[model samples]
Target: MLKQYKESSQQTYAYGLVDHLNWLDANRLTVASVRADHLRLYMNALTGQGAGVYGVAWRERPPLSNSAAANVATVVKAFYLTSNQADPSVVAWFSRDSSIPQHRRRAVTQNPLSPRRGSARPRFLPDEIVTALFEPGVLTSARDVMVVTWLVDSGIRVGGLCGLRFPDLHLVRDHPCGQRKDPHVHIVGRDDNPNRARAKAYHSWRTSPDGYVNDGVIRAVSEAMIGSFYAYLLDEYHPNQHLVDHEQVLIHTKGHSAGAALTTGGVRKMLRRASQRADLNSYITPHAFRHRAAANLYAASDFNADLVAQEFGWSRAEQVTELYGRSANRHTMKYLTEAWDSIPGRPTGRD
Candidate 1:
């Protein structure tokens, strides 16, 4: 079962199944003897008195959320299916229409415990806020500014940023790095990164096949962003001591962990500190830049959904770009109306 799953996904499934296995052990219920009622009892226990968040141990904490419960149920169902696949004799016991009374049809068919997902607006950082981040003294060090710049320019996830390596960067305008015409950075997924930042995908891509590089997705970044990176490398980074020779892109500027790769938590902390220094009064997350960039691209491209989707690396099935189109069109309509109103004697009164 784990062999067919991605490393990250396998880790998630393994973690979720621990609770189910523990409950099974406590009740003396083997894979061959488990029934729907037993699973329901486990679900009840999950949300009963206390349960921590997803990926957390089943200890005395708050009750499991609807989404969390649904996730656990999904993992448990997958476990049973995998077990049955490993041994055919257990198939009848876990079948949807088996004679086992109290068998859960919902578990096999769908997750009834899952809440209906509602459409929610994507959060974005305002243009002013992003601009303020680059102003002198807004961030404590040049590295923070560079981090925020990469987030805005490339719109990569925090995990991708954390996993960035010096070799992955091709900032030169026309370097012989790969076939790509523009400057870009490669985002590679690795489970062994020191910072614990893993890319969402396993396959690696390159803009140009200049040479064999780390396996990961390639994303084009703005020249300004690349310049900011060099500025950090020259000023704050090289002058500081400790791990003078490192391959990671972003590093801890100060403290005992100086020169180490910045973890996801470190990135969030830097954002909070930068926001406070800039007097923004609101903590801007790295993901917010993704939404902002997507919406901005839609408006700039005259509400072209395909272009926005391609730029953001969203799959065709993920039609969430349509929502961004709607928002973009509203702004365009306002501009069109203003332009019409400016015409002399145009629609001065209702006809």
Candidate 2:
């Protein structure tokens, strides 16, 4: 049942199911005996306004945010579906489409998943934050600097960055794939990695890391990023004799785990500490770098949504234009207003 998802996603689904199981145990109900009413009670308890105890061990935990609730519902549904397929003896007890009688065909209001559309507004870091990240001493480690440079320049997800192998990088202008005017990195998903870092939904090249049978995508990197990467590899990474056999791009250089592969959470924590040291927003997330890169690419491409989408590996231009083009949109709106006001006989506010 867990084989369909990436390791990280499988872990997430496990946690969500654990939460549901905890609720069942606390309510003295068994999964085999559950029905729509029990599901409603469970959802109500998750929301924390219901009559029963919220969670078995979540007494101190607050109600889940809307997106989180929706995700939990999704995982729960998957669990039931997988279970049904695995063992049909268990009754088809809960369903997303199943409805409660009182709510006008709406699936039991309490059992229904929270609306998924109200996800938090996407945020992109300003240009100044990028400058701050690269400032001298802001990131003391070459590895940190290189990581930031790659994220901003390549716009790969943090997991993809963590999963990166040395051989996947074509930092030079030439490669077996073809000659390129610019350097680029190949992003692929691997299920066997110790760090569990992977590109979401990218499994085509899972078995062939450096082969032509890759379903992976290549993203161009700036010369500056390439320089930083080499500096990190030659100076920081290669010097670690312990990591001579390792293939991962970013490795630990401090503490007992020096030269070991870095996990995605460890990278986020490293960035947080660096941001704190630099007097920047400590809440600055890795994804914010991706957003900033997408926005910058959009603006630099003259608000060409397709160009931005291609650069960011988004299948749809709408994803780039609508979600990640805030900075470019600001520029676009300003230019439109300026052109309108400059027209001959255009009405002015004072007119």
Candidate 3:
């Protein structure tokens, strides 16, 4: 798991596996002893359907959500598959014949308890709430403002945003790094970052011979984003001379951790606090801005999925279509209304 997945993902799997292990111990069941039926019972216990040996423990906590339970099932299945590989005697509860003849003879089957995934959809913040967030006194910190602006404008993931470095930003029309005609920022992935924040799409970036990143998921920045960044640099960022030099773009502005790189967790907490201060009814997460950006870009481009995918660094246009294609904007709504009204022999309520 550590070799195949990121540290964060591996940690999630480890935590889930621990719970499974504890449940197995309580039930006196080993990997070889557990069967598909037993695993289904485990899933039931997780979702508060059945409490096998730890009824008291189960009652203390709320049932896991369907998605979370599904994730646990996935982790358990993966664990068993890996265990089976390490020792052939271990029961492979999720193994089945491969559908493709040329592929491996055995394949891992999906957990019966895992929920079927629904079609992807945009989960964006409304324009009014966004306006309220930016209103005076709502978000006072220049750094906070910059962070929100970049998220909304660039649709960069929280991890990528926090992982940014000074060298990744080219805030001029003509930067020495590349031939881009506008200001942009690069999302680079590095495993050794002290904050453990990394770009989700790490494969999209590479350093050039001159120590400049000319190939990466480059996102154009809005003038407002640049202005807020400059404000943060001038008013908030004052790195201590004694600390070791690091080029992380976003750093703590106050407290003992001042000048340290901000983590993705910090960014999330900031957004939550800001949302509360703004009196927002719904909690606004960093990813909500990405959804808004994708929807807005899709609408602005006359519903062009390809353009939205390209702008947001999506690997496939199908991703944009599945996620943002059906997101209705004012323009789309108006067009549909007009088309409906223009249909021949259509009933008019007034008539």
How many clashes show up per model? 6, 0, 0
Off by over 4 Å in 1: 1-3, 11-73, 80-110, 205-216, 240-246, 278-282, 320-351
Where is model 2 poorest over a 10-residue stretch in terms of lDDT? 85-94
Q: Encode model 2's per-residue lDDT on 1-351: one tens digit a residue.
A: 666876658877787788887777876777566665556557777766568533355435888866577768877766766664433332344343454465566434433444334533467577787888777887888889888888877677998999988767877776655624466777877877677787764635433444532346668888888889889978888789565456888888887888788889988998888788779855578888887778877888888899877666778898876677755566667789899999998779893
lDDT of model number 3: 0.76
Work out the TM-score per prediction.
0.70, 0.78, 0.83
lDDT of candidate 1 over 1-351, digit per residue (tens):
556777767766676688678766766767777765556556766776333222334456566755577667767766777774333433443453454345665444454333344454665567899889888888867888788888897778898888888778877656566446677777777788877788776665543455535335667889779788889999878866457455677788888888887898999988988888889878898888877777777878777777777655566614645455544444667789889889997776776
Model 3, position 65: C-alpha lDDT score: 67
- All candidates: CA RMSD in angstroms? 7.0, 5.6, 4.0
lDDT of every predicted structure (CA atoms): 0.70, 0.72, 0.76
List where candidate 3 sits over 4 angstroms from the true fold. 6-8, 22-30, 41-71, 84-92, 97-113, 239-244, 328-331, 339-351
Model 1 error, position 217 (Å):
2.7
Instruction: Assess the local accuracy of residue 167 in candidate 3 as a C-alpha lDDT between 0 and 100.
Output: 80
- Tens digits of lDDT, candidate 3, 1-351: 434666647666777788888888877878777777777777777887754523224234687867677778778877887774333432333554334364644353346556445665656578899898898888878889999988877778999999988888889998778747799888767877788888877655667777777767878898988998988888887544245257888888878888888999999988888888889987788888887888888888888888787777788998877777656454567789889999999997794
Clashing pairs in 3: none
Clashes of 3: 0
Q: How far out, in Å, is residue 252 in model 3?
A: 0.9
Better of 2 and 3 by lDDT: 3
